[model samples]
Target: MKVGTKEAAELLRICTQRVRQLLKEGRIKGAEKGDRFWEIPLFDGKPEVKEGRRGPKPNWKKRVSKAISRICVNQHLIRSNSKHGTNKPVIRVESRGIIRYFHSLEINGSCKVVYRPDKPLSCGAKLWLEVASDVMLTAFVYS
Candidate 1:
């Protein structure tokens, strides 16, 4: 007795595509390619499925380690800068990406800072603006 790929798939409890793949891979015997379908021997047992390596590949660890190292280096630079003083440039231009420049400002005087970009920011920009300012005791007493 012979059955088409669809009927074979139903008997094997798998998809028709898998049945066709098994036939092509010669996992099952007596499978003849018909006009538009495959004729598989109904007497043959279900083909065995070999277990393959699952989940993400092992090479991801190397890439992840590189990323973590980069982050650590950036953190070290920030810590060293803070210990020395805020002498670093407030704005730094990059060669690529949407954020053309990186801006980090620190104000320690009785003044206000404003950021007015020429074009509207679409993404990759974080604006940390505080509207309210605390008045010092001396400034309030003098006023």
Candidate 2:
């Protein structure tokens, strides 16, 4: 059976723009039926949704690296030897495994550290560390 873009969007639980995007990306099969109208075919098989399929599944190490990069970009890092004194650095942790993981490095003049809990931590947890006055860092460690 053929369905319009609105029907397709409703069935897919996504915005119509997303439906059009999928069509443009060639992830879903559809055809232009008329002026400003498109038809999507109904299939018995499961809908094949593509998410990050162009590359390999991100490894844990790679995820941690990317998370750390994000944190560095978001926060300032205070170094160990700032004359004004140090502030507690903020640690953001995310995990995909049972064992805890730690990714540590010094950025700017501060020590930026990430710690993943052995078990998944609560969605929001506040942790502390020491850093310079001008530099603050956020660290995220994921399993």
Which one wins on lDDT? Answer: 2
For every model shown, what is its TM-score relative to the native structure? 0.30, 0.31
In order, how many clashes per candidate? 0, 11
On TM-score, the leading prediction is 2
Runs in model 1 deviating more than 4 A are 44-143
lDDT of 2 by residue, 1-143 (tens): 56777756654556789778777777775455567777677553113344546666423212212112223211232343244464434333232222222345344554454454553224322333334323333344533
The sequence of per-residue lDDT tens digits that candidate 1 reaches over residues 76-110 is 44576699975433332221121222334333334
Candidate 2 weakest ten by summed lDDT: 61-70
